[model samples]
Target chain A: MAYSNKARDFFSNELKNINTAGTFKEERYIESPQGANINVEFPVGAKPKEVLNFCANNYLGLSSHPEVIEAAHQGLNERGYGMSSVRFICGTQDIHKELETKLTKFLGTEDTILFPSCMDANAGVFDVVLDKEDAMISDRLVHASIVDGMRLCKAQLYNYKHSNMDHLEEKLKETQNLRLRMIITDGVFSMDGDIAKLDEICDLAEKYDAMVMVDDSHATGFMGKNGRGTHEHCGVIGRIDIITTTLGKALGGASGGCVSGRKEIVDLCRQRARPYLFSNTMPPVIVAAANKVIDLISKTTDRRDKLEKNTKYFRDKMTAAGFDIREGVHPIVPIMLYNAKLAQDMARDLYEEGIYVIGFSFPVVPKGQARIRVQVSAAHEKEHLDKAIAAFTKIGAKYQILGKKKDEIIAQYGY
Target chain B: MSDDLKKLIIDYVKKEYLDDDSEEIDESTQLISSGIVDSFSMVALKTFLEKKFQISIPDEKATTEAFDSVNNMINLLKEFNVA
Candidate 1:
């Protein structure tokens, strides 16, 4: 059968254009599972093996943790491999309930619902809760998943400037007559690593009678005293109405997510969210492993302590080397490179120095604000961090970007 | 071209995609190719168009080519008696 021109055009010209733009990213396959340092096989022409792994979501050195692996193995033996159904269907295992219950206790919430991935947790949220009479006011710099979820709902949407409480309050006032109002923000923004103003957002939520939701994907496993999330970092854990976070980032670096909050809201999400209703339940092994992760995280503070120290060490050293770094309390450290080509070039050179980092550019972030987002981890020792810093300083001098700042540019413009 | 319909489409696109005002969107611009329309945007547009035009865009016509450019989208809407 002949395909439609639409399909032909999509597969031919448009797809070709997108791929040709140097933006079509292909994943580098890792022979081993994710960890602090992983070995990835390169393409035919390039070197066979590249060392140094600075690009991963495994913040606590727990992706390959021995206990987590054993727990996963035990679950596989007990519960089998796959669930083959959604959570409401024949997929709710004992481990799933255990994980959900533990998550509720860990987050200090009324209840929790698990999704197969954090992306789905984000994509499924708004459709379930927000109606035509509702409003969702969000931050300008929240994750892509939150934005996607908000689009799926019938709620009136407004975006305030990032972390700007005044704009958020104004939006809250504008939408006060709506049946429901929610102010959504990221606990720790992934790109720039900036922490959100959750305390202020919660105060405004109380003042305006609006509910607050925080996507704590980046903050969940390491931010608070017990790694509860950004709300814990801000000392307002129970004040926020809803918390959506990923198990994928720091909670063992596996793939899972949960929405924890008031039981009514979670129950509604379970009933209506399309991704949740349609997607298969998480596998038994993954669930068991994640359950153990929740258990481990609640009991220990070692990983969080290590990550905090590494972050401070790297941030301090990078600043001393005269690099303009984005200010934040998270492991996501953005080293700003204003030009797109410069960012790409710097990433390439960094890799040549046996350090792995990715360049963030336009479409992913605002234009003229591209950077190398170096993620610190509990796995990184002092030697690893110092070596990475030396590599950065060397490349910075080579690229003539060592001492350039916004002030320097303004002075050059004679402003 | 009724101003209301044009404004409705534009408003839907602007709000749903979280588009900034500086990104020069025009009727001839391709929403998908220009990165204004991703998977979730596609889902939202599908739902919105179904309600607005009172006709369903068949699965065959739901590819990026049909919804890419605003002109192309308008043409598809014409099939559903939009204009």
Candidate 2:
């Protein structure tokens, strides 16, 4: 296609700015399956090398599990490939209904409705239910999907401080003149592995007569005692009004998500949610594998237990090594580098040492809080953790990110 | 008082939006266009300015013209005679 000079110049300048800003995102190709150790080829033409992956969302490491693969294979043989239609049409299958039932039972919700992805699930929710008369009080640090969803809705929107119940209450009070109010937050914030104070949020919701919604994408498969979610972990299992989560993260790392909640909400989503009504149904193989993953996690707590132990081991060793690690039990551990260049350099050096991790800087996270986000999975063994920690310590010492108080580093960097 | 308000907002932005000494942000620098402060940060900043300055920013005055830069924020405050 030919472009006008004006459009071409505009896009070219934008690309140049992105490149000059040191924020241009580049994708690396993985030659092997998703796991703790995978073969990656960087620089496009380079040979693939085995690197210990610590950046995937595969918390339970079921992304390439043998049983999950086998189940997908069986599903393909039994149910065929794609649905090629939306759920309300001819796409509805027994397996699809079965998976929804399993998710509802697992989440302790009255009903569930699946979507192509959690992004779609989030995008479809707000506009359908809430109108101009309603108000949405959202955590400032909620996922981008939630922000986009709020934008699509006509409801009066207000963002409170991240996970601040007092700010939430203030917003609720400010919007009290509205007909209906809903509070939205992430169950576990992806950037920081901090779990939301759902119990407090639920209490505030009750006090203000508002409904609570949580996007538990980061805490679905192995968060609570039974891996129910943050609501279960925070002792507000039945208190939450709506829960949106993904099968793409922990539940076998396939591609599907669901909004599970009261029957009316699910029914409304099924009827009016644009994504569900427009997008094709999830492939049968993925649904089957996700169903199997839920069954596996429900039957045994082994994966979640291993993940917990690995997180503790890595967190303790890194902290003991004088590396400033964020205090959290979740696997998403941030080794603070404060300086964006330092973070990028450390991640590059770690990759050279055969450990794969990504550095997050401004826009993705708040500015001046740059860090290498290390995601530990149940798939990582003790040796893998040891190797990653050693690489981190070595990189840390080289970059002078260790052997000093976090405050000292921040002050030195003027961050 | 306007200078003090600008200083306060600059310090807050420096603490919250800056990570290193690479980028120079002045009073006239665009906060939203330059990606220093996003929608979320805008909300927080609005709350902070309202509480600290003891002035209510009406819904119509909450756009980029009023809050895009330290200078603009100070101008808005001065217009309200709060600074």
Instruction: Pick the TM-score winner.
Output: 2
Chain A TM-scores, per candidate, are 0.95, 0.98
lDDT (C-alpha) at residue B46 in model 2: 84
Candidate 1 lDDT by residue in tens digits, A19-110: 77657776776677676666666553454465577878888888999999999999999999998899898999988999999999999899
Pairs with steric clashes in candidate 2:
A368-B19
Instruction: Single out the weakest 10-residue window by summed lDDT for candidate 2 chain A.
Output: A157-166
What C-alpha lDDT does candidate 2 achieve relative to the native structure?
0.88
Worst 10 contiguous positions by lDDT, candidate 1 chain A: A406-415
After superposing candidate 2 on the true structure, give the runs of residues whose Cα lies further than 4 Å from its correct spot: A411-414, B1-37, B40-66, B73-83
Candidate 1 second chain TM: 0.81
TM-score of each: 0.83, 0.89
